[model samples]
Target chain A: MGLVPRVVVDVMPKPEILDPQGKAVLGALPRLGFSGVTEVRQGKRFELQVEGEVTEAVLADVHRMAEMLLSNPVIENFEVRVEETA
Target chain B: MGLVPRVVVDVMPKPEILDPQGKAVLGALPRLGFSGVTEVRQGKRFELQVEGEVTEAVLADVHRMAEMLLSNPVIENFEVRVEETA
Candidate 1:
């Protein structure tokens, strides 16, 4: 067996897009009997499982992928968290 | 005007799903003379912009929304980071 590396990617609105979904859901909140919510916007997330030993070098390569291929720096930012399974 | 709150949502692989897209991209690496990458997986990310004063209480409502509608608990998880803009 080998150690697996996983990376979590989070993407969000740039604060420019009119969040209709967020608003629609927010408007429905009171009807749902949940009046606590005031405003809502939704985001997307990604999970990746990698192979090989967990090392900073390995992670850097993954980070490069996130920056280059996986995530867009213009409207999104991402952080990588490695899971333990040895 | 009020401070706008934003949450960055990241979703990724469960480590169980066979990541074909990730693999296809990885397999193409060597052709580009980039032999470093061996395996890869893809994921989705979301960005949300919220309205109102950014406070712990306000964020609590937003957090609850994430748990309720924005994300799935099984095979998925989320984290909240509020942006500051006054």
Candidate 2:
């Protein structure tokens, strides 16, 4: 591990929302000779390197960050967690 | 678990490459009152629903998909794994 710990935030579209990018990929799959994939959902992943240790307070702040900027609550859901460093 | 299994593919830019999007997010963070984050790297996460059981062969195919379409091998690296369903 480096001197700083890392936090991972994943922002994904809501299940009800349509993901055109994913649909495009799904359509292109079979054309590329890849099959058996029924659905594909594309999302964003963010890795943040924190200056200090990952405490509950920092995690809470990260959650708030996810809600306020990383994701649009109306159409997306966000998950925040600590990513173990190698 | 549902009738089908889900595979997760994460595509991230190589560490040596410049990530302008992530840099933009990092620049906007402090303006949004988010601090303590030294660095940020943004990537893509893909959730793929497979029609049948997720075997090693399926995983291999997913890896190939990641290499051929999901990511640009010249600048990005991808990881493919089965996502456990609830």
Highest TM-score, which number?
2
DockQ score of each predicted structure, in the order shown: 0.30, 0.89
lDDT of 2 at B69: 93
User: Candidate 2: which stretches are off by over 4 Å?
Assistant: A1-4, B1-4
TM-score of chain A of 1: 0.65
Interface Cα RMSD for all candidates?
A: 4.4, 0.6
In order, candidate lDDTs are 0.59, 0.90
| Ten contiguous residues with the weakest lDDT in model 2 chain B | B1-10
Instruction: Output the chain A TM-score of model 2.
Output: 0.93
Clashes of each: 21, 0
lDDT, model 2, position A72: 95
Segments of candidate 1 deviating more than 4 angstroms: A1-4, A15-20, B1-68, B71-86
Cα deviation at B39, candidate 2, in Å, is: 0.4
Q: Highest lDDT: give the candidate number.
A: 2
Candidate 1 per-residue lDDT over residues A15-80, each given as its tens digit: 666667667777776665555444555544444455556568767766776677665768655667
User: After TM-score superposition, what is the CA distance of residue A3 in candidate 1 from its true location, in Å?
Assistant: 7.1
